[model samples]
Target chain A: MLGGQFLETAIWGLPIVIYPFLSGLMAGAFVIDSLAHLFGFKQFEPVAKLAATSSFAMVLIAALAPLVDSLQPAKAPLELYFRDHFPYSPLSVFIIIWTLYVILMFFEMYFDYRVENIEKSKLSGIRGSIARFLTFGNNNISKESLLKDRKALFIISAIGVPLAFAFHGYIGFVFGAIKARALWTSSVMMLMFITSAIVSGAALVTLLYVIGYSYYSKKNVVNIETLNALGIFMIFAIAFDLFLDFIDKLYSFRAYTEADVFHGWTLVYNAGGVLFFNYFVVQILLGLIIPLILLIFKPVRTSKLMMVIISIFVQVGVFAMRFNTVIGGQLLPKISQGTIIPEFPWLGFDGILSSIGLICLSIVIFFILGWLFGWEDSNKNGFENQTNSVDN
Target chain B: MSYRSDFSLKEADEDCNQELLSANFMSWLVKSIALGLGGLFALSILNSSDSADATEKNNSNLPTGPINNHRWMGWENPVLDDKDGWNDWDKLLNPKNLPVWYDNFHEIGKTKPKHHWVMVIDTRKCVGCQACVIACKSENNVPLGVFRTVVQVMETGSMESSPNGMVVTDDGNYEPNVKKFMLPRLCNHCDEPPCVEACPVKATFKRQDGIVLVDYEKCIGCGTCIEACPYNMRFFNPVTKTADKCTLCVHRIDAGLEPACVTSCVGRARIFGDLNDPKSEVSRLISQYPTARLKMSQGTEPQVFYIDLNGNLEGNTSMDKVFMEYTYTIGFNTTAYKKLGGEVDLPKIEEHKNPFKEFEK
Candidate 1:
């Protein structure tokens, strides 16, 4: 609550929070995709293709969220193109990693959809023509070529796992490395960010899988085992995330705000505080606790409908975590004991409305990618199986 | 039988509605109490923690791991990296090392600085005139609200209104218990600036002679630097749409003139001069006085040394109206803004249905 020389308007606002959450979702989805290809988790097989597609869509949207947050969005390209962009700056590191990662994801998706693209090229329709153009005419559908595609995707996922971690870790470091901020200075910030990212990513995949499968399948009954595995993965992620929270909270006890107030106790956990609700209720209780409790019961985890609801709660929880870390960190000024109000502009480019628009844009991209890639055909995905035989 | 059935159905609807309402109220009560208990528990913990001893001083045990790793990271400033990149701050604090401090600064080919700039603020002499504040605005075209430099009045509770029937005068010290005084505040232009490193684009850079400034063209206004600055010196300029901060009046310094704020300082409290020349007034005063810096433990190593400045600046105060009138807002104080020669016209206030409109004549 250091009310010193505080800004009238919050500079980071909702966009900053949304940017990190979206990117985290991207990274988390990448992690799930990799779990099947890289880590040999057969349970994650069902969601791998969906995860990759979602990851690609999210990366684009997450990247744009920052541009919206920047005052001079036009100059954002200069971050990469500008000569002597400071190499060590977290933001600079993020841009380079993000670019490389996006390209790698594109390649992975290209390979995933390559076989399908070739199959469609034989048909007589606009989608087939479009598929032919998308394939770039190297459409060798021989058994060896399918193996080669699988090998390529395998290597890409391997490389992408660390890159994905680095990409998301950079966002955490961007705030965590700031020596001036009391709340953001903890050593565990990056780890916490990564874990929470996995939680949100896993949850979103679970939600989409449940909903998407029902939409695509004639029978309402879906893969209960996959949903259970996702729920288990989420529980572990949330538990790890909560443990980090515990450590950070205890460490903050030692830290002091610039205003001579307790940094952790006053701003973070104080009951009447705005940060309190964001941290405890939205983030911990409804987001993590209740969801965790529901998922622990065998009855809830086995049910697709219940898993969907839990996934929603997890996304909301992770979102609150980001909101708390970004906006809540800036609310308390460094000068003295008081807070600046975070007046969320519901309109304007930098407002909450714009963030909602960006999210919608991401969903639209997901739908477009699904249509373009012919993902409605269940046999088209599943990287390992697709390489085994050609679908005629 | 039909009449009895209708009556029973109506009774069931009423019972169901009442049950739902009670359930809603009960859930709300349970949730509120749960959250409230967490807050109360937190408050009690805070109280217990506050009663701890002297180690609870501000910035004690401050975390500075990333800042301390410049040498390890091998990311030292290329120009000064080999021999003079890092300085032992404790060594520089000694007056005997003043010449050494000036020697290594800014040695680029044929462009080495002759004078190392430092500004010393004497808090005892500040009268809270608001002249420096106004002069800075007029000189820099600073917008209606924010200040590049402003004087803050720290009221020490020891001050008495009319103690011992002694009358307070312009030049007289009437009350011995009085501690009310003005402490002029501005950017310290820190040696180990956190803002410079945090800036993603390196838009903010520290000059050879200790002046840290922002390159407006490169700044994307990510506000990373704004958060990095512990002193709250950096701001977003609405006109430029980039990050802005106090530049130590480098333009005027190059022009062989004092800063607008320094030139207009009536009390002569602010003395800016070269640390290169030991005979300079700034060097002499700094050597003589037991000077102190704010939040020194944060390790920014602030360049502005304050004399007779007690570190008890009480805060959590509301923003003053003048400070509240930032340019990014829909409207601002026209009367106050005109003083600074603001050009923007007043925006039309969106009419609202007044709650007391019914009583209007």
Candidate 2:
């Protein structure tokens, strides 16, 4: 046959990559929060409030990722819900599930902080006024009311566990459901997304807890037990994530169809240089394997500085995993036999700037929430000691 | 720290006053902006709905006579009368010569055509002229860097000989000679289109007549449909800010006119008609030839069929030799080519010296 060239451009870019990464963080953080409240894990008690609020903040920002990624952000709601409603679409289902998850997180956080909100409402200034408003005019801080709030919080957190999994799992299904793209169509894609989300989420919250407690609090308090527990969780999640990656690769290799072969070659042979290096070096070796090996040793897991450093690597590696999944899938032409498309430009509306800007904005929002809620003051013993002394 | 009794109520009141003022101002600003944007969107939607209602009402009131008036097309025209019609109206409406699908008029008791549109590409007649591609671009105003229809050329076989010997003289050996074929691809308008299922907003959908169309106004340009399509036929139209693909020229089809690509095929390679009608050209060709659809294993049940699809020309298996040659344009870079780990440069096209004529016995 005569040789003719066909050129196809990458349609989805950085925004798509960032959106899934953000959503994964939201799901992962919320699951960690649930581990304390529902399962009664005493080791996670110190960071329980931090994780809950962080989860709430992450969802708020994560919701905006897809909207900003849209070419028509303003019209998205009208188009999605009214004009072009497809209830069966995974994306539409994701939106519904994500909204419910956010609401559940909000209620859980609100009830957990209700008693504190009543006390803060007595203080002078805008902080007090905001706290008062948040309490919904019911200043009842009675013991019975607090017990009811605890029950509600426990129930919501329990519900939130699976909802968080579903939220991130559906995000995976968004790509996995596309039967045409061999790389994304695996049954393991959803499991892979969930596991990686846990790794990234745990890493992020660990970093935040260490930084927030050390810098923001008056006493510069550091909960060694809590940090160590989070480190252990991150290690296990990363190991599971790596295991899933192995299973996915094994399945693809065994299937060995033309499309599967092409997908495998693309990743292994550096068909797209960025994807190959990103997967092997950054994601696998540095992100998953190194972190796993480091966390297994008691010295590294117990050392606060070492744990922080390892978590940072885990975070970067998990993000790289998301990048490899989202962008790598689009790199190849849908035709199994076709060549890969060019890399998307890093500048402009759909580029890396949008991704970084959104992430920075989310971080800023989280810090602002942390300050407003006085999350830095949330020490388990510190709160109990102060209240007991006051009663005496 | 002392309990709430430490601060005076007057001090708290002063602090509350300042905070309330700022909070009220921020709330007001947000409300006003939201209201302003909401009004504008509502107005636009209302105006569009009003216009659509008017068009429907006008169409229902159209006159039934002068069925052969070309100016009326499928759209109604009350001004047209039998007195102003051409003499060949009876000849044009004759079912024996023309299929029932050809009639666009809505007579009082006339039934709608039981038609399912399809296309048949006779690869044997194609000469890689790319006339259909140009015609489709012109008709659809498809932007550069993306295509609604493309004529891809596939060449196979290697130009190297075995290590231990001279070049083999086998007919199947492509070392000294290569065989090429042209494939004109467009939207398959599949019976079970994945794009429709993948569209979160349902912006892309299949019509009752089997044409896949994108609702530009409703599309948010999330690009999910573009990823869902196995053919890579869909593209993000920057101008429209929506996902776009070949609509099979529904505008012309509705008017009983052939698609621009079908009309402009220089080699008479493309045949378009109602596949449901056994006597239609496309249906007849399907029956006569052992036609094949691209990626049939995908189960998309594509409507477009190809005649005489040669071996090694199936699917995108032959894209290794295919090179996309075009002038560099902004927003039109081929990421797929770069991802394939190839040097991103346009190679010189080799002129064929009528090798078939030279090799003839």
Candidate 3:
């Protein structure tokens, strides 16, 4: 989809600047999981699961997103993939990692899901025979196999974390590189993208799981302990993201050229008054702060329903944050100096709206697949089918 | 025994068709929609190109001229069609193309300096006539409405009088007496440019002689360098679908001729030379005089510079002024039109001077 968008821009002169955000979201999801899992944030387990699965699904969608907007959709990848000059091309790097990350996530999920069937088959003679057949007739669920899976997950996630950062960070770096425009120019942008990715990922997974549990089990299995812990993490990530943006704008506002000031104001305000206040205040205060307060409050943190509402708000906030960073960053006009004046129609609708719709649709598909694959399976029964001894 | 059999049977059912079914449906739906949307997007792009061509034909009825009057080509023609000397709604979106002869005629270096060509725009001589902007566009086949260079006017002092009998400013704004001057700015083409460093794929790069250029083909339209530049010079060319900025007329400079802006300076205020050569006019001016670059402290190291920038016309001062009030003192001087054949008594310098310097500290 991303390739198509690029192709469209190259061919049709599409005015939309939202293509990078969609791709950033894809890689950003996995990056969030790597942070939670590696740091051993058990409260982030729900977030981790959501990030892993959403990123997994988005990888497939983002790969095609650019193509949807390109003139020669088929030939777009050839620009980077062709062996003539493949090495060091950023697109080539992204394509290679995108493929690797998706495959790694797929195998990780497969290995994880197979364990459940192995345990179920152990209960009966006939059913055990069937479970044995289903799991390639293997019956090992010992400490050795568990240890191997744990190690594999750790290694992959370790490597995947940086790759995920590189993936989303590359997008920020791309925009920041343009010195012709004062609005998009900043060294801190890539780091901002990476940090925000964590924010979005943490919020997304927590919200999805709570909803998933409520939808399927009807008993609110998303524990308050998990929600409270994840909510706290969300606040930290969000605050950091906001701070970086403030520093960038404040520094520019002091000495901005007329064009820079114009662009800067557009970035901060847009046609709709103060761009951040509308999206960010709601995203931060209502989405992050309220939930954070709830989690900190003794009464709300213990309630499953309250926790569920807070998680939903957090996830929504994260999405809005991405929208603001990606879209708001580009809203500023180029070449502002002195008393910066706002200009443009610099942004447009076509690509942004289409991408949002497509991403939502892809997410819906991800949930349906999760439902069928039994995403709710507990670890106790899922590990028995491993042929090798389990450890860890 | 029965429970084990049932569990195995369920596992078998899931593995056989249930798992593949969900995955396949998702893959199919996503892939198909993606393909369809992708195709539509491509078709629309192709259609836009065709539409532009058609609009070009219809643009003959339009007013064809330069748009923002800046040196260098813009992405679109300056014309918007009119009916009976009024606005023509149909021609607003339809753009016209440059003359065929304008394409590829002057490849630069053919008639001008081969490399390291530079220009010094003397603000003292500039009358804000905008001749350089017009001359550059016509000479370089630049498109209308977009400027590769801009002449900004800085006005300082206030129009109001203070309570004292003296002609001091009462209103705080920089409008008194209107001591205005024009600063024509273009690509600095810095030696260590921030734009080049910010580009992820090296789409925009600095030449050996310090001219920064963009390769339209290689650019993915990511707009990274636009954000990197503290100077807002780069513009997104919607037609070419790439980021563009001034290249200091490298092509013209390479042709062994002066840049359009330099040659077009009617008052001879603009000077072009090779700073590396000690004999060069620019080198002579820089070594012998007080010259200043735009935003020197930012460390981009811009090649462009100015001379005789008055005391009130220093660096950016808006932020400092908000925190404190500044005091300005006026002084008088006489510049004789003829060469002074004899020494004349000069007025004593006033010790109680302007207080602008305190803000910098």
Candidate 4:
């Protein structure tokens, strides 16, 4: 690679990529959950428990990516917190927003699982005793109290959705705010991130909803209408996301805007480069377009198998977009004329292995929470059979 | 009962589907508008973060040293003049307005500084020597693969009409007719240093004397400062796990001696002095002759000025010339100094936790 003098060797590697991918899924899933609780979309209610629980899990894992990425992982967050920080710095603001969002997620899950906890408290053994403890002494499962819980859920969803947006949007701002990097200086970065978050999050929730419902009920049949609704959201979200990327890239060209100082547009546009493959081929073509096409057809949208495949592609695209932003932006030297190729981080604390570990950890946590609280059983007995009553 | 999963979109009445569609449309309409508005609000704040009117500069949020009056370091700045330009409807096309490039002397601090530091380099007089670069390394104890200051050997004109002709190396990719000049670069210690603004943890800050230093204990080793510098002066210190850069030899300057680089310049190409004191050599040289600074378009307000530059610094990024991707950097400087019969053992300086603590008698 012909790079200029002193290309930055401390390139932020794959951990930063996983950070946004997970956070987007976190936010996007919560937004989908909001359609039912906040907006009274009854058809979406069956998937609500699955979406919210998965969102909670994503947040837990997403939080780890940055901590692992920080230079002094142990010391860095303390300084960012417990010490003075500039409001202009997005990282400073994100910590506060993230904490609030985490608290919000916990409350949302509590209200979501409250009735099940009340019911489980009646059974014998340690599980019953644990459920009794989680009920917080208010064992009432009356309609009024449940309606009150519904109102509370609505409020939590309202705040949760934007807080989720803030969490993911702040990540975008961390890159976009840097005026020197031509590739990331796009004003539309936050919009692109939010839109893509919706796309990926919806896709993941759809996939999880289909898969989780089937696994929990020990049946292949699930709610087709709810799956179609998620699919519709996925299609629109992906379309809007693609439009944002188009605008971001189109204006980033030197011909369109003055901010493309080092020809960041050219690097991504260059057919010969890795960034071009990440941005154009994997991110735009496979990740977004393919998923959008797959989700658009009615048969595909309703088919549980097809939904899972499209969601995976959507995730791939979102991850590639993040890879393009964080890694691609660092390829060119700030002071020199040439480009620097980053060594792939296959090993290390924040390497690809740790990322895979983090994902597996989140999945483990998700199931443990599911087993302890019976999130699957609640969905199955409560809303599951009723929603599944409709023919596919 | 309403919260229970009794209602499905099986559309009860014939009109129910239409009502549901309108309600969903309205829900999306409100959300889309909210998202759009939130984005605009964010864009407005971020673009205006560095605006001039952040007077009293309370928002900078640096923990140590009072960085008050240094916000734009007084109104000789192009960026400050356009502070209100963000509100103008015509200027809405660009909220992140670009700053016009210009140069002027910034008095070091609000209260008169006991000593105002400044540097003026005579690029014409520089003999492409490695003296200053070697002295700085040994004095600062800059680790391997990095340097505090460097003399960038750059070229002008085409590969043809070459001065040295094609190198004796047969396969070398050499540009012909390219006239080479060496430009020495270190920390500019800008009046409104961008690194200070970029740090999230308030690790890097500019002192009253205009010497920018990193609080090593405070630094998170984020590498944002290294990118913020236009001069490429900052580097990640592998030893300390902190960001390292030229402090303009703040330690030596405090001891009433010249910087190591200044003392070692065989050609006396680098000049350093108190610019506030009009009788100083730096002040005299700047007033006497026309001088230019590198990358003024960046609006960092770099204090280092160059004389007889004569198109040496234009039409290129930092360090213009590249012969086999080689610059007379730290390793090469150490080798050249040894060839010139310079000694190896230079004293190692301890890292200062707080270099800019108020001067005590």
How many collisions per candidate? 5, 16, 96, 9
Docking class of 2: acceptable
DockQ: which is higher, 2 or 3?
Answer: 2
Candidate 4 residues lying further than 4 Å off, grouped into runs, are A1-7, A123-126, A216-221, A259-262, A372-374, A377-392, B1-108, B161-175, B310-325, B328-361
**Tens digit per residue, CA lDDT, model 1, A360-381:** 9999988898888744324534
Model 3: per-residue Cα lDDT over A159-215, one tens digit each: 777777777776565455444444556677778777766666665566566677667
Could you say which candidate leads in TM-score? 2
User: For every model shown, what is its TM-score relative to the native structure?
Assistant: 0.75, 0.80, 0.62, 0.76
**Candidate 1 docking class:** incorrect
Residues B194-224 of candidate 2 have per-residue lDDT tens digits of 8887878866666546677776656787877
Query: Sort by TM-score, best first: what order?
Result: 2, 4, 1, 3
Q: How well does candidate 3 score on lDDT at residue B330?
A: 8
Please give the DockQ score of every candidate, comma-separated.
0.14, 0.26, 0.06, 0.11
| Sliding window of 10 residues with minimal summed lDDT for model 4 chain A | A1-10
DockQ of 1: 0.14
Q: Indicate whether candidate 1 or candidate 3 has the larger TM-score.
A: 1
**Model 1 — TM-score against the truth?**
0.75
